[model samples]
Target chain A: MKRIALLGMPNTGKSTFFNRLTGASARIGNWPGITVDLLSARILLGADMVEVVDLPGFYDLHGFSEDEQVVRQFLQNNPIDLLCLIINATQIDQQLPLALQLRRLGLPTVAILNMADEAEQMGIRFDAAVLTAGLDSPVCFVSAKYGHGFSEARETLRQVLERNPPTNAAIQHTEFAADEALLAEAEKLVARSVSMPRVLEHGLTERIDRIVLHPILGIPLFFLALFFLFQAVYTLGGPLQDGMTWLLTTVHDQVLAHLQPILPGWLYGLLVEGVYDGLGTVASFVPIIVLFFLGMALIEDSGYLSRIAFLMDALMAKLGLDGRGFVMLMMGFGCNVPALLGTRVMRSRSLRLLTMLIIPFSLCSARLQVFVFLTTALFSSTQAPVVLFALYVVSFLTAFGTALLFKNRLPSREPLLIELPPYRLPTFKQVILRGWHEVHHFLSRASRFIIMGVVAIWLLTHLPPGVAVGGPQSLAGIFGSWLEPLLRPIGIDQQMAVVLLFGFVAKEIVLGAMAVIYGLEGDALSHLMAQRMDWVQAFSFMLFILIYTPCLSTVATLRSESKSLVFTGVSIVWSLGLAWVISFAFYQSARLLGY
Target chain B: MSMVRLSELAIGQQGIIGDMDAEGQFRQRLQSLGFRIGKEVRLIRQALFGGPLQVRVGSVNVMLRRCDAASIQIWAER
Candidate 1:
């Protein structure tokens, strides 16, 4: 299939446009699912089969953000047959540099002036014929949200294909030199077709910016926004989450009853307990995670996310991290995997590495299961969200504090510089598509990893090799014994110690180990531990989790991204040291206080 | 004063980028993105909380944390 790449700046509705062209199924298989990997979908353009690849939205080809690199690689490697370059019409001047470079690359490029409705609202006007004539290529006027000019763009692509276009002979991989010509061409085109005659010189961006950027009140307002975000994640998300859990388990029970008559015990257990229950635990939180992602997606889509970055830039600089660093930190809450993947957005290599080093400190959504499960079991439902929120606060502090120390101790760096896109409403189709893609990814991992994890824990807890009278001689016991000394400072016993040991392999496995140790009710282990260990031990456990070694895949990715064994090793050591010191401090202080 | 830090400057305050004193990998990055001297810049947006400030230079909207903003020196617009 001929690959068609969708290219644009962040918040230009690139994904929205991709969904309009290729539909949800294409995007699910491609970029939205993994968040790290670029995804492709096949489209039938009349008789020709075209592969539409939705690339990460980025500013210019010059930056080092992972998404930008994705674009750069596609350009350099000549992966796609055609480039569908989407530009937000409102920010044409700012976003045009990348367009200029793509034209110089001599790719069969079509420019779709997206968000035309928003542009019209702002009283901006453009002549498409003039734009097309100026760029020397077909330009289509599209509002991806409203589905305008989409078919025309596809037709234009078909026509471009029919021409039997010569493989862009001018497309040589050289920097600045090649871009110089493209920039000149774009400047000429903008001068002819696009006109912005200082319309409303002092607009909303300027008016609202004063108080928002004001030294005294700005920080407090930002905190309130974050407080509301966390509150919404729980208060709004709770009932929906409870309803989803009931629905999934109800289905699981019905399926078990239907199969029980024909199937044997092991077979039934394997299907219902091993696969259904385990995967259900991971999938049960989909509603809350989806809601959380939806809120984030909307903010990002509306261009408000950049404003948040703009607002936080100063605070981050105070903490010794830059503005771009906030993106990686926010992404960490989604999943540490992609958060680490997102470090590529940092313009500097050290900042990228620094962000990566601190990412694990940001509490991922998947780990919320462990936190909520532990807190609710030990305390009340009302106290659960607060406790969990506190842990998140601790995690945030850990990231900031570590970044500060690293900045002061490691080396000082330049201030941040980033492009800020204007805010716009994200489409439902796009939100659902992106959410579905991410949900599918979590399910895929659960199917593959959760099954193996359950089976392994089952074997470790059961069998001829199992412990006699359940007193630490089983397979899990042997592993726990090896890990006991290491975890003793954190006040964990052999059993809890083993869970921590397996936590390194995959975080979800920590849940699996708990299930095995405490039976169907994970609360049994939590309640028992709550009696022996006070609040300090719990805090210590949270700290260790925050700063300890990342799961295996993260380590591998760090190696690949950093391309240095030494850097990876340093990350592992520093994380371990930080965890140890924090946990040790908490444990010692607790003992000193007679807790 | 020679140059006030970019983050400390009020919105609409214009200045020339004086120095970017960041180090390590990010230092190399600052060099690559044309954040060099003589570029005209102004603060445009600030977040509600003591967050990053959005600044404009030429045609670009660059967001920097207040702290990083402090690292950048700028002369007031004449």
Candidate 2:
């Protein structure tokens, strides 16, 4: 299939255009470097099924940033049939030079003036004919935000592809010089093709930024936004999750009942108790994940997330990290996999590594669910939120402290240089699409590990021929007993040890394992936990959970991202060690205080 | 006749970029983002506790570290 690549400077709505053309929901954030990885999908243009690749945004083809390197490497390796050079219409002067550079590569190029509606609103006019003539290519005015002029652009691409343009042989030898003369030439072309109002008009984005980025109010407002986000996650997500759990349990019960008579005893056990119960428990948390992504999508699309980088830059600088690192750390609250991937936005390798190291400390959604369930079960409604909030605060403190401790040990040489895009209210379509994209990504990536984990636990608990499930004679129980001595100092008994061992697979499964081990469900399990453990012991247990080794998927992600087995191993050791010490200290201190 | 480092420019102060004291990749990045010599720029704000300075160049708003900003000489309009 012929390949068409969408290339552009950052924040020009390139991903939106890619999504419109291909029906792929690549993230549409109003920040640079959001598209760090190459995203390709098969898109239909008229009668042809052409492959479309969305390259990460780059300011200059010659720039040496990691993002620029990725784009250059991809273009060099792939035989791109056509290049759709998307540009922000309002910022044509700055954007056109990159277009000029790309066209010089001899690719069959089409320039898309995206966000045409926003430009038009600002009284900016562009003569497409003039731009087309000047650039020696087809120029189409489009509004990826509102879905304008896409059909024309698509038809133009189809015609260009039908022509079967030869690959750019000159690309290998081409020297991209961002000289004054070249820039002036591109500027003159932009001048000839576009006109703007005599008086520049500041729009709603500027008006909002005044307050949002205001020095005193900005930091507080950022925290307030985070508070609201967590509030939504807890308030709105709880009932939805409970309802999902109920529906899944009912389905699971019916499936098991039908399979029991038809299948052998072991097979029936594996399918129903192992697979269904294991996968279903993890799957039920999808609603909460979706809600968290929706909230992040809104924040990201509105361009407030970058402002967070701006606000936190100095604070993070003290920890030898940039504001962008902090943003990635915050993303960890949703999922460590994406957060680790998000480190690609940082320009330096060491900074990326450092940020990756700190991310596991951020209390992810899985851990948050565990905290929510335990705190609510163990404490009154009034005290539960406080405990949950304290966990979050501890998570941040731990991550920051880790960064500080490792600053000198790790290489750190990236300077903070980030774009602060003007804030725009995210469209409903964009928000929902992004949210759905994250949900799909999470399910596809994490479900395998969760299922395998659940099944493995079920096997350990059910195996050994005639051994009772979760009994002392069973494999899991025996293993838990072996670990009991190690955990005794922190007040974690064998039952808690078993649950924590399974929790290494995925944090969400801890509650389910607890339910099975205790032979109780829901409130009964909570009551049982309260009876077996005091508040101090329970709090220490929760603290240990908060800092222990990350889930399997997170470790896998860290290994892949860092590309170092030693680094991944160190991460595990560090977290496990810190968790033990902290829990021991808390338990001992509380006892000494006579609480 | 006096010039000021871009970092020293007061909030809302407009200036023409006179020269950049950076080289290679760093300079290339700044230029690509419309921080080239002779371009008009305005100090939007400085972040709290000596953090990066927010600057506007043409239509793009960017945050620059104080050290990076200090290397760019700007002819401020009093």
Candidate 3:
């Protein structure tokens, strides 16, 4: 099978194009030499099998961004047979140089001008035939949304392959001197051949931007949108969570009951307390993931995400980051691992590093379960959401403030030159598909972590009857107890401290550890912790969870991305110290104020 | 006079930008986004917090740091 690289800037409907070409078998992986993602698929052509690899989007070939570099390096190393440059017809100028460069490479190239419908609506016309004749290659104006021009593109692919042409070495050196005259000719061709309908002149985005970017009101408005998003998720996901929790708990109980008479005590305990309890703790996050993804997909598909990035570009710039860093931070709310991976969008090394450093501060949805489970069992839903929201705000504010204090010469802002695509009602298919993909990835990751974690926890806490001395008082407890005094001001008892010590492995494991520690008897430990502990303790617990050392994978990812274990070590030490100090201060100060 | 600072330009105002000092090594970065001097520019919007300034130049939206804005010299429309 010939390998065909599907190249374009992100959000140019590259994935949609990939899906159209090859169904579910598209393999998603990281691009070599860069963290930017790559998606490739295998499709059977007329006589030969072919592979289509989706290259990360680049605004310009000359620009030195990671995604750009990913595309450049891939082309340099694994030179594909036919280079298919997918262009969003709406924003052709920014992408044109790369297309021209690809053509210059003299590679049998085709320009699939995607989003023709959008371009047509915008009153932009491209003469595909002229464009083709000028570049001496085929140009298919396609709209992946409408499934337009797919057949033509496929036919072109077939014909290009039929030639069985050898790789042209001349195109490789065209980077040093771009054939601008050829590009001009191509532009002339577009002018001659493409005829666009009269655009319905309107300025809805302009009007919305007035309010959304208002100097006095924009920040508040952005926060308001965020507030409503949170409210919608909590208000909607709450009932569904209760149902899910009930189903899981009921199934667990029935399974336990069925096995009670047949199995030995330790074996039954392992199944019920270790496996079911651990998996159930992770599963409880399902509703939050669903609702969070719903909100994210809505914002993303509606194109408000870029505006939000625009809205915060200034503040981010002041902190040596860019607006897109906000997206990484928001994605971190889903899970810090992927969120860190998503930082591939930030082009600068320092900017990427700073964003990665700050992402763990976002209250990820996984931690939301810990808050909801503990707070609702102890406090009201009204109180729980508010507290969770406040914790999120505090963490974000802390991260922002930290960034401000450490203001150094970081990567300059890549001018917020972004194309704000019009808002459209999200397609149910796309949203559900994306949501299912994320949720399944999260669950799969969680399952792996939880199984290993539960087995380890079972070993640490296991002991003979009446021998609490060996199990809970073992090495883990000794270490946690050693730090109890430091944490005492924050009201973390030795048991909670032990769970946290293990939590450094992975945050979700903290909940799993809690479940096992409390013996998983109808969630009695969560209830007990909430009921017996003062609000200060609960608040302290949340605060500590907020800023504690990130999971092992996060630290490793940071080290790999930043190429600095020193920074990783520094991040861990600072978060650990900060978590202790802040929780201590909150608890102590609140106690002094007679809470 | 050299072009006025982009930060000093009014919304909807068009200008011809001159040299930008590119403070903190940001000049080339901004230039790469079509924010170089000699470019025709428009003040799109200014976000809250006295933050980065947003401007449109040749069908693209580019964000400039407030510090970077001070270095951008633009000929404000008379």
Candidate 4:
């Protein structure tokens, strides 16, 4: 199959173009050794089966950034057919040097100048003849967002592929001996080819940034945005989740009634309450998690996320963490597995490792389900969101505290050189696609642990001709009693203690396992949860969930990404220990205050 | 034109970039981003005390730290 590798600098909409062309949300499989994630898809383009690989964006090929290294490694390791480079049309002058560098590689190459719509709005005009002639390559103007210029580009790519064919030669990689000359040449070419109006026409993005990036207003505006985001998540998502749970459990009950007559009690319980109820419990929360992802997608694609990085760099710097790491940390709230996977873009190993340590402390949506259920059952409507939001604040505190503790050991050398791109309201389609993409990843990667853990917890309670379901003679009861002593200081009893152990597989299972272990479902489970723990104990349990070791999927990702057993081991041990001490302190202190 | 550090330039100020003290990968990054000798750059904005400064180099806006910005000498029109 013919292969085309997509390459570009950051913020060029390269991945957007790749997705539009391929129409697939390609998964990032484990590609070891500094290459954490790379996306590729196979698609047929005009009588040709082509594999399109999206390389991480980087400034210069010779640049020492980890992204640059990954690009070089991929190009050198695998033989590729065509090098397709994407450039932001508005920033062609500075970006063309990269185009020039790619042209020097002697590989079959085609260039796409994306965001042509924005370029046109700014009164930036490009002389196609001059651009193509000067660059000495085939280049096309495109706006990936509107799906314009794609058909012609597709045809152009096919023709280029036919002309060059696949040489089947190894593309030897080497640094540019003199990037200075190539850069000079690119500037000279851009000068003759691209023309722009003086004063740059109008500025919507600038006007918005004036308020959004304003020092005092910026931080508050940021918090307000998050506040509204979470509000929307609950107000809208709560009903959808409640409705979904009702529908699923209604179906589960009917199936259970029929199966209870046909199958033995053990088989019936294993299938219904063990598998269906547990999976359905977590599955119902999917809407809320997807909604959270959509909210974040809007913030990210609007270009405000970068503004956040700019606004927050100083504050986080004081805490010994960079602002960009905070972006990954926010992503952790959706799922810590992706958060660890997302750290691949960073150039510094130390910074990446530190970020991995801090991300697990994020109250991911999996844990969010447990917290929301417990809080709603315990607190009134007005107080539930507040309690939930406080957990978020505490999660952040734990992240910063971890950073402060590890900053000396894992010193980051990368400078805070982030691009504050012009704000563009992200399209509705793009936001949904992002939401779907993340949800799909979560389902694919996390479903195994969710199903397996639920079954294990179910079997533990059901096996050996139980004296009474979920009673002291049962395996779950026996195991929980064994763990009770360790957890006693933290105020978690035997029944809840074992749920925490099962939760290690995946945090989503904590709530599901609770339902199964307690022999309760839906409101009854929540009712029991509320009655079982007082405010102080409930608060301690929430802290324990927030600070404990990362879910197994996250641990696997950390193991693979960090590629250091010692580091991953330390991450687990440290979080578990920190969780114990913090929970113990809060429980003891709160008890003394007579709450 | 008297030289001033990029971090020293006020908001809405314009300058011609001059000798930069950056080295290695950082130099290459800045140079590729259109921050070089004789390039016309502008201070788009600055965040609160000792934070990142938003600067326009050619057509691209970059968020650069104050410490790094201070290392670049620019000839400013007062």
* Positional deviation of residue A211's Cα in model 4 after best superposition, in angstroms: 0.6
Best by lDDT: 4
Model 1 CA lDDT for position A420: 60
Give all candidates' CA lDDT scores: 0.69, 0.79, 0.72, 0.82
* Candidate 2 structure quality by residue, lDDT tens digits, A280-398: 65666678888998998888777788899999999998998989888888888878888899998777778888899899998987887677768877899999999888888889988
True contacts kept of 2: 0.64
Quick one: best TM-score, which candidate?
4
TM-score of each: 0.62, 0.69, 0.66, 0.71
Once fitted onto the true fold, the runs of candidate 2 whose alpha carbons sit more than 4 angstroms away are A1-201, A249-268
User: Tens digit of lDDT per residue, candidate 2, span B2-67?
Assistant: 468998899999877655777556766785676644467899998889988999987889998998
Q: Count the backbone clashes (under 3 Å) in each candidate.
A: 32, 0, 9, 0
Alpha-carbon RMSD, each predicted model: 19.2, 18.0, 18.0, 18.4
TM-score ranking, high to low? 4, 2, 3, 1
Candidate 2, number of clashes? 0
Q: How far off is residue A487 in model 2, in Å?
A: 0.7
Tens digits of lDDT, candidate 4, A251-279? 87766667788897788788787887777
The residue pairs found clashing in candidate 3 are A1-A49, A9-A57, A105-A171, A127-A194, A314-B52, A415-B63, A416-B63, A417-B61, B3-B74
Q: lDDT by residue for model 3 over A165-196, one digit each (tens)?
A: 64533235546334334555767998899743
lDDT (Cα) of model 1: 0.69
The TM-score of chain B in candidate 2 is 0.93
Specify the poorest-scoring 10-residue window by lDDT in model 3 chain A.
A195-204
